[model samples]
Each structure stands twice: as C-alpha cells, then as structure tokens.
Target chain A: MRLPRVEDIEKRIPRPEDFTARSRGPATTARVGTALGIAFGICFLTGLWSHFQYSSPGWLPIGPNPAWLYRVTQGTHVATGIASVPLLLVKLWSVYPRFFLRPPKARRDQLLDVLERASIGVLVAAAIFQLTSGLLNIVQWYPWEFSFRRTHEAVAWVAIGALLVHIAVKLPVIREGLGASVEDETPVHSDGPSRRAVLRGVTVASGLALVLTVGQTVPFLRKVSVFGVRDGGGPQDLPVNRTARAAGATRAASDPAFVLQLKAGGRSMSLTRDELAKLPQRTHRLPIACVEGWSRNAVWTGVAVQDLIALVGAPSGSTVIVRSMQTRGAFRTSELPGDFVDDPRTLLALELNGEPLSLDHGYPCRIIAPNRPGVLQTKWVRELEVRT
Target chain B: MRLVRGLLLLTGLGFGLWGVWLMRDFTSEQLVSMGTFLAGGVLLHDAVIAPVTVLLGVVAARLLPGRTRSVAAIAFLVWATLTVAFVNVLSGQGGKPDNDTVLHRPYGLSWVVMTALIAAIAATVAYRRRRIAGPPRSR
Candidate 1:
C-alpha cells in the first residue's frame, strides 16, 4: 500500500490551534523542558555512576568509605527518573501541536524539517523506553527478553544524545519561548484553562508523583509514599527483595550438613554453623541498599571478612569470591573487591537486629559489605575463595 | 551560539549512533520487540494520554460551574495520581510470597484519605477566595 503524502496527512489531522482545549504553547514547553533537562541530567549522571559501580574496571576504584555514597547516588537516580515522568508528559503535550505543522515547501528547508522530525522521533521513543522500563525494573518486573542493564544504558545514551540535538535545533525557539511570561501567550480557547492554571496543574501533578513514590528512598516519607514498592520494613525492619525459596537456596541453605568453606593461600578450612557462631561475633549497623533504591539500616552481627581471611592465612588486602548456596542465578556468585574485603565493617552476617537471620534474610550466613550494592552482598553464602 | 549548537548536534549524533551500534549483539527478535515497545510508548502517550487529558480539561472547563471547575480539576488530578501510584496494587500484582511488607499498606484507604484531604483543601481555598471577593457577582 502507498503511504499518504504529507499534505494529505496534514489535511486529515487537526491543527494544534484548532483544538478547543489547547492551552499549552511554546512558553509552557520551554518551562517544562528546562525542568526535564535538569531531571534528566541528574538521572544520567547517577545512572552512569551506578553502571560503573556494577561493572568497575581495575583502574576505576570506587572508594570503600562513605558507606552511604552509593545509596544516595542510586536513590537520586531513581527519584529523578520517577519525577521526570510527569515533566516528560507535560513537555510532550505542550509540543504535540508541532506534529501537524505543514512541512516547508523549499527543498533544503524540507530536508531540514524531515531531519528534525526524525531526531524527535528517536528522542521521544528512547525517552519513553528509558522511563517506562526503568519503572518496571524498580518494581522487579521484566516483560522483555533483553538484559535490562545493557538495554537501559544503551537507550540512555540515545535519549541524551537526541535531547542535546533537540535542544540545539530548538535553541532559538526555546530562548524566545522562555523570554516572555507564560501568561503572555494567547490561549487557543478563551474559556478553557488558563496557561497559569495549566502550569499550576503540571507542577502539582509532578510534585504528587515525586512525593508518592520517593518514600522508597527517603525514609521520612515512607508513610505517605503509597506507591513505594519497598516499604523499608521486613524481617528485622529490613526489606527482603528475594527469598531463599525464591532463589532456590532454601534446601541447600538449611541442610544440616551445611558448612561454610574458606580457601586462601592453598589452605582450605570449613566452619559449621555452630562453629561460625562460636567465632568472635561482631556487630555493625549498615544499610542494605538495593539498586532499586529502597534501603534500611540494621544491626548485622557476624564475623568480620578480614577475620575470615586471616583464618585461612590470606593477605590483608585479598579479594574474596563469595559463592552462595543457590544452585543457579546471575548473582549466586559475587566477588568482593579488595577494598570491601579490607573494610572493618564488611561482615559475613549470621544475625540481624539481635536475632538469628530469618530464612528469607539469608538465614545461616550472608555477606554484608560497606558501600556495596545489595546484589553483591551474596546471600546464603556457602564458600569464600580468596584472591591475593 | 552556533558553534555550541553544532557541537551539541554532532555529539548527540555520535552518541545515538554508538547506542544503536551497541545493540548489534541483540538478536533480531529482541530488537524488533524492543522497537515495538518504544514506539508503543510514544503512541500511548501522544494519542491516548494527551487526547484524553485534553478532553477531560475541556469537559471540566465548559461544563463545571465557577470555582467548582478548579475543585473538580484538583480532585480529578488527585484521583489520577492515586490511581497511577497504586496501579500494581489495584491489579493485585503488588504482593509477594512470604513478604507482606512489600506493597503491604492499605493503598485504597490511603488514596481515599489523600483524595479527601486534597478536596478539603481545595474547598477551603475556594471558600476563602469567595470570602475575600465579598461574594460571587449577581450574574
């Protein structure tokens, strides 16, 4: 089938000015664009940090101290992303009128117009993908087969690139749009909502969105953040993302014969659950900060990672490869960076909040390290291999 | 300004192309599926969401009485916010096995309370505005 010409498409589609409820205009778009620009910038930077933390190169050293650094950055990343949802909607709506604008008649101008539209299509598609998929990820819902991390990072590059291009192309219009007050723009419908009212509504909507969901990261807002997926409350007042049964580690973890093995300097030593408890138990209060952004601090009681390394005659700054009892999963085995292993607070935790660990909370033993993502803190840990 | 714009455009193009290149490892099926999702998102927002929002705004503007329109709009926004916020809960997908604390709060009650509070505030503001204006003009 032959596609319709631009003129024919324009003829069928209603012009933005013709819509009775069209109160948004260039000024509104610019204002919303500014807000979105800031939000996207923050989200991008934080996202980059998170990605680097997950896939750090040997030369890139993420400091071990300031245990809350990753927590705040990842939290900001998710919060800004969620807040951008409303801003993006309003910004897109404000500019929706341009979709029906007649293409330029001049050959060069027409080519430029086509190029601009194509860029916009890319930008819009990428932005929507990043936001929606991000929200799904936080909720632990994967509807697609592609890896979320790689796809998200790749799409982020596309979105930001398109955003910069759009801004560059629209620079003149943006300046003009923002120069005048929003009220100066004439409303298409005199009896409809005023531009000021629309602005107010947008602000309210965006604020509500932020307030309703940000409590997952901001502890004070927990009660009001009804949309927060993680309530910051679980066994020992710490939320559990994956249970032992869910990870297929229940049987392996709870087996009476379960013994945690440590290998370092070609010497292997195994400790039973009771023997682990008999070892000098230390308590450290650290937060289990998940990449999804919810975090809660708990008093974790167990043996220090350094002490475990020392038991096997390993060097002071040796990296440890932690293997979990789970038969299969992406994070069933994790490597603790040398810095994390050396940190005094890093523990192979046996209890939480002064009680024995619950089955869902890595019952027998788990790795808990400072400034580390929750996924890296391997649960139901069964083996530790040291690398000098 | 022109130089900056040019630089930005070129940089943007470079990043976009690199992003596309990175997806070379993805299977054709995955690419097609992801493309569909991306396009569907844009269409959903532009076609369904924007039009519905405009229609609601128009209906509220033309039909509702003075001051009540603002109240209605605020009420509608609050309702929409609550709905979007609790979508998973409403759809019964928020719960997890052996984990009551995840999405455990009474979201329906919270929405009601929150909406009522918003409506109450809007009414109060409207009442105060009327009081300040001395009364509605005898139209």
Candidate 2:
C-alpha cells in the first residue's frame, strides 16, 4: 500500500463546516466545556474522598464526626457522575466537528494538533469508563471482571488529568468564545436550530436527568424519581444491598448458638440475642448511607459501642475490630477508629425501624456508626476484638 | 498561560502514564477487556449516541411546525435520552429480592406522566405567546 502524503491526507479530509447543519465553533464548545468541567471536578473530588475513606491512609484521618459526611460526599459523587452523562454527550456533540478538521500544514502545529487529539481521546475514553462503571456499581451490576474500586479510582485520575490539560490548552479559546454573545456571528446551518435553541435544549436535558435520578439521594424527590435505583424502601423502609443469603450467613445467623462475643483487656464475654436486648439501649435516627449513593434515615435501637466495650472491661476510646458472622467476603472484619469507638452514637444495633433486625438487615447484631460507609457498618456482627 | 498549559500537559501525561503502569498488575485478559470497554465507550458515544441525537434533531426541525419546533424537540430529547440512560432501571432489571425500594416504581408510567406534563407546559406557553401576539400576523 502506498502511504499517502500529509498534504494528500489533508486534502481528502473535510473541513468541519462541510457536513454539519451549523458552523461548529468554539462558543458552544466553551459553554458545554464549562458545565462538564464543573461536573468532572465534583465527581473527581467526591470520588477521591470515597476512595480515601476505604483506604484510610494514616496521614489523612477520616474522622466519623460529621455523621453524614460520607453519605453526602458519596451521594454527590454518584449524582454528579450521573449528571455528567448528558453534559458529556452535549460536549462531545459540540466538538464532533473537530474530529473531521483538516490536519494542520505546519510541522509544529501538526504535532501539537496530534497531541491535542490524543489528549481528547484519553479524556473521552476515561470519562466514559468512570461514568458507566459508576452507574453500574450503584445498581450493583458488574459487567466487567476488573475490580471496580481500583479501576474506577485509577481511571478517575486519568480523566481529571486529561481534563486539566484540556482546560489549560483551550483556556484562550474558551475565554474568547465565552466573551462573545450567544447570538454573535457564529455561522449556523441554514436548516438547523439556532445556538440559543440548542443551548436551551441541552439545559432542559441536563435538568431532566438530575430531576429524574437525584431522588435516590435527595429525600423529598424520592417520590418523583422513577429512575432512582434505591427508592429508600426496603424491609423497614431501607434498601438492602447484600442480603443474608447472598452473604452465606443465613445458617450461622439463624443458629440458636449465635452469640455476640467480645474479647478485650484480657477479658472475654458472650451475650445471647435476648441478653443483648436487656442492655441499656439507645435509639438513633441515623441514615444508613451506602457508598453506592443511596441512603435512608431509619430509627436504630441498640447499645452504644462504648457500652459494649465496657462489658469486657476495655477502656473508653480503645480501637475495636468488628467481625461479621459471614465466613466469607472482604468486609467480614472492619476496624473502628478510636474516635468512632468513643462516639456515643456508634451502636451495636439490634433493631431497625422499631422492629427486630431482619436477617438480611443484619439480624441478631450489627454495627452502626455515624458518617461511616455502608460496607463499614459490618452487618451480622458476631465478634468484637478491642485493639490497644 | 503558556507555562501553565505546558505544566498541565506534562502533569496530565505523567498521571496517565502512571495509570497505565498500574494496569500492568492485571492479567492480559483483564487488560484486553479494559481496552475493549474503553474503546467501546468512545465508539458508542460517537458512532451511535451523538449521531442519533443529531439525526433526530434534524428530523424534528424538518417535520415540526416552526412555533413548536424548539419546544417539542427539547422535550423529546430530554425524555428520550433519559429513557435510554435509565433503561435498566425502567425495565425492572435493577430489582432485587423482596426489596421493593430498589427500582420498584413504574418507570414507564412515570415517563408518560412526565412527558404529558412537559407537553402541557409547552402548549400553555405557545398559547400564551399566540394570545400576546394578538393572533398570527397576516402572511
């Protein structure tokens, strides 16, 4: 095959204006870019926060103080991601003509143009991965075999980085484009909608996306959010992500010998289901927030974690590890920070919504802490080990 | 500005390379699957979603009357895009066990109601505009 010369290639490629109904220009691109920039920024920051909460590095102490911190952040992460779907589509549409633009003739400009196109490819690919995987994750659906957490987090860095680079490169054009009025002398396709009309359509589309889906996180809008994955309704008006049967804890959870064991300060204690109920119980109207961006505020009644630690003669503020009865899964054991151990609201929850905890809802015993991720809540808890 | 752009470009390239390096730990099959997903995502958006949207818009512009063209197109686009994005949830594929809370609503009916509401609002706006203009001007 004879290789085509650069000039020949340039001659063969069509200009952006040749095929489109309107003159594809920088104005719409800048407008859409601004919206996408904000959305991507929110998604990246919130996603990073969610990642940190799981990893819990030593330097960045993720305190359980705010009580609703993870709930709000993770919810915002998923919501922003969902909102980006329309924005991204519009953004890509606005720039679709650029893909067909004739390559620059100058050697320097050609190299730069190639670099710019490559960066865009990376940005688009990473953005799609992040959004699709995230949406799938919220619905508890995994189409790919790769671990969602690592891949999602890793690609997020790629997306945000490419986004920053894109912003940097396009800053001048963006400034000029935005400065021009929406109705300014941008060429339009004789048959197509005006720029203002297109903008209006995009705005309506974005708003519709938010309104239809945000109710998964926002309490008031739950009724209207038909597309919401989590409707905040479950066994006791709270949704369950992992069921007892799914976790393979049904047998052990229902066994009469099932007792919550505590070991701390060289002392050990065991309490039956009935005995646990007799302890001083407090009620908390805290929300069970999941990392998947659904949450419900339910009345949880149980003994404070502090009180439970005291039963084994452990000092207050001691770090404790809660173990679930499920013999399998990564979250079978979870460590509570010293501060969380000291928080009075942190509980060994025995009841949810005024009823005994359903087996799938972590019956017998479970840990409920303020501002903790749902996975860290550690349902079907059987053992508590206090760490020095 | 030039310096900032250069610095950002370098940083972005660095981060992207690091991400690629991280993927080295995965098996070749996982890497290949990841690549397929990444490429498929771009293709889906570019080849299917954007083109379809543009085609729909063009058809609507050509077919719909002038006064209602923009309004109808906007409403239709909103509803259609949402339906596609939410097909899994709408079709009850998101349902799990006895948990009626996860994707429990009648999405098809809700979409109808929402579309009806949008149409009503658009009609009202058009009617008011017509009234304010004191009927269509003589051609």
Candidate 3:
C-alpha cells in the first residue's frame, strides 16, 4: 500500500520548531535530564547490589560483617526510584515537543535519526516499566505471571543501555543547551513559569516526593513517609514480612511438641525451645533489613547458628539449610552459607527486643543473622540441616 | 568525542538487546503484559497527558489573570506529576487483609497534605517573585 508522503503527514503534527514556549527549550530539558541521569545511575547501581545479594557473581563476597550494608543500599535504591518519578515526568514534559521532530531531507541523516528515535522509544518504555513495576512491587502487587525480579532486572539493563546511547546521540546538543541561557530571545512576554523557575520547581517537587516516602528506610523520618509500604512498625518494634498465621505455622510453632532438629553427616539431634535456650544464650543487635527496603534494629537473643550445628557434629563454617515450620511459602527454607554460619553472631533467635518472639514474629524460633534479607531469615525455624 | 559516542552507542545497543533476549522464554501472556505497560505509558503521556497539559495552558492563558494562571499551572504541574506515581499505592490494593501493618498509613490523607503543601509553597514563591520584582511583570 502506498503510504502518505512525509510532508503530507507533517501537516497533521506540530513540528519541533513550532513549540515556541520560552521555557520549553533544550536548556531546560538538558538540566532536568542531567538530574534524572544521576537518579537512574544511583538507583541502578544500588538495585544491582540488591540483586547480587540473591545471585552473587562471586566477584565480591557479600559479607555479613556489616549488618547495615543492604539496609543502606536497598534504602537508597527505593528512595531514589521514588524521587525519579517526578523528575522523569518533568523531563518528559520538557522534551515532549521533540517527539514531533520532522525527518531530515538527507538520507544519511534520516537513517541516523530513525535509529536515534528508536533508541529513545526503548529508553522511555523501559524507564516507565521500571518505575511503574517497581511501585507495584513495593505494594506486593503482581498483576502478571512473569517474575517481577527477573523482568525488572532485564528491563533495567534495557533502560540504562538506551539511556547511555541517548546521551551519546545528544552529546553535542546537550553541550550546547547547557552552555546557552534557557531564555530564548530575551523572554518576549511569557505566560507561565520562566525556564529557571520551572527547573527549580522540578527540583523542589522531586525532593518533596522523595522526602515524603523515604521514612520506610530512614528511622527518624518514619512518621512522615506515609506513602512508604513498610512503616518500620510491626510486632516487637520491627516490620514482619510474614505472620505465623499467614505462613500456616501458628499451630506448629505454639505446640508443646516443638523441637528444633539438627542433622549433619548421618547424625541427628533435636532440642526443645527450653533446651535450645539453655545452651549459652547470646544477644546481638542486628537489623532485619528487607528487600522491600524497610529495616529496624532489634536485640535478638538465642543460641548461635554455629553452636546449634555443632551439636550434630558439623564442623565450623558448615553450609546449612535453615528450614522453617511455615512450610507453604517461598523462602521457607533458606541456605545459610558457610561464611555466614561461621560468624558467631549468626543466631537462631528466640527473643526479640527482650520479649519472647511474638506469634506473628515467628513464635518459637527464627533465624536472625547479620546483613541477610528478611525473607531469607526463615521464621518459625524447625530444622537445621548442615550441608558442608 | 566521535569515537566515544560511537562506542557508547554500540555498547548501549548491546546491553539493550541483551535485556530483550532475556525474555525469550516468556509466555505470550507475560509478553503482552509487559508490552501493554510499555506502550501504554508512551501513549498515556503523549496522547492524554501532553494534550491535556497543552489545553490547560491555553485555557488558563485565555481565561485566568496572569498571576493566578501561572501559579496554578506550576502547582498543577507539581501535583499531577507526583499524583500519577502515587495512584497505584493510593488504590489500597497494597493493603493485606491479615496484616494491618503493611500499607497501614493513611495515604489518602498524605496526598491531601502533599497537595496543600505544594499549593502553599507555589503561592509563597509567586508572592515573593512579585514582591521582589516590585511591579507586575509579564509571565
């Protein structure tokens, strides 16, 4: 089918030059885009670190020594993502006129232009996906079947990749825009905010967006982060990912027959809650930092994970599967890596904040270790099967 | 600079394609879900959001006095930009039936506070701009 000529279709769409607003210039776009670039860069790096926690490439050892590492990293990731919402929108508003860019008459320029536009399409789509899906994930809402983590990771790369290419393609324009004044033809009787005022508004609005929702991570800011999914409030003064009732472990956890079993190298040992408590109880201050980016420090008191494994004759630094009696959910059984278990601070916690573990906070027993994801803490822990 | 730009472009395409390749095993449903949001975002912004923004600017310019129009436009820009992001969480779908602590805060009230604060700030800034300039200036 013969398509309409480029000039024929151009009549229906406004050309980039037709946008005459003094504030809607490349300078405003470049400034907002620069801030957005930094936000995305920080968010991507921190998100990659959060991803590495689950699947470490072994280039860096995710040590348990620094209990606050993931807390800070994931907190920054979520906070930065939140802040970028307004930044991205404002940037798009400034750059929207460019979407109507007319094709060049030169064939070579047209080809390059098409390629650049395609790359921009990819960037915009991927960015919108990342921000929207991330927000949904914060609320634990999964409207689709594909894995959130996997798709989120894959699309993040796409966004960053296209973003970098966009920078390359626009480098000359960006340089020129940044050097020039935002005001075109000495302002000439404008109606809305000046280019400078718009930039300031964008910055202030984005900062407000961030400060309002960052309380999930910043302890002192908890009261103000009403939009934060996890409010740093739960049983025993720490957020709980899963309740005993939700995990279907309430009956098993509260039963008088509850005993923690240890198995390693053809040897087996079981100890009741009282028996486990009597074996050199130790207290450690550790934060239950979650992947969703909420964390709280608590005084966890119980037998050390290394000590519990020793009863089954497992050597120190043994890898173990800490299985929870809440058998129905994901991460019900978490692998405690050799290095993590070797640390004396790793504990099968029985007391939280000087009180017995609340029924919702993993009743009889739970795994409390340094720098571990909250989901992998394996609440209502029943069996410690040493693998190494 | 040309060499750097070329290298960046190539590396970017490589990474972007790799991300696309990762979804080779996704079911049709998954792909559709992904595409819906991806394309929907662009369409929503370009077709709906942009046009409304332009229309509002034109309407405000024609109908309202200059000062109120300018301040309102900026405040709307700030509020709408943020509201689009806050819509999902505000839907209350995030709340868990058994767990009251999860998403337990009054987000609706928070949004109201956010709007009031943004309007107040915008008005204050506009008032100061007028005060400092010492005369009513054209936008």
Candidate 2 lDDT, tens digit per residue, B1-139? 7898888778877877777766769887777777888999999988898768767866876886555665665566566656655755655554456445566677788878877887888778766756776754446
| Docking class of predicted structure 2 | acceptable
Error of 3 at A359 (Å): 2.1
Candidate number of the best DockQ = 3
Report DockQ per prediction, comma-separated.
Answer: 0.48, 0.47, 0.68
lDDT (Cα, tens digit) per residue for candidate 3, span A265-352: 7899889998988899999999888877778889999989898888888887998998888857777888888889999889999999
Off by over 4 Å in 3: A1-12, A182-185, B124-139
Q: What does TM-score give for chain A of every model?
A: 0.95, 0.95, 0.94
- Candidate of highest lDDT: 3
Candidate 1 local distance difference test against the native: 0.81
- Superposed model 1: Cα runs more than 4 Å off: A1-12, A20-23, A185-188, B66-90, B123-139
Model no. 3, DockQ: 0.68
Ranking by TM-score: 3, 1, 2
Q: Select the stronger candidate by DockQ from 1 and 2.
A: 1
Instruction: Compose the digit string of candidate 1's lDDT tens values, residues A1-388.
Output: 8899987876887775666543567777888899998899898889989888886777888857798888889988887887777678767867877787877899999999999999999999999899888877776777787888888988898999999999999999889878868674554344445566667777887788788878887889988788778778887778998888778999998898999999986799999999999999999988888888777778999999989989989976888999998876689899888888888799999999999998889979999887888888899999999976
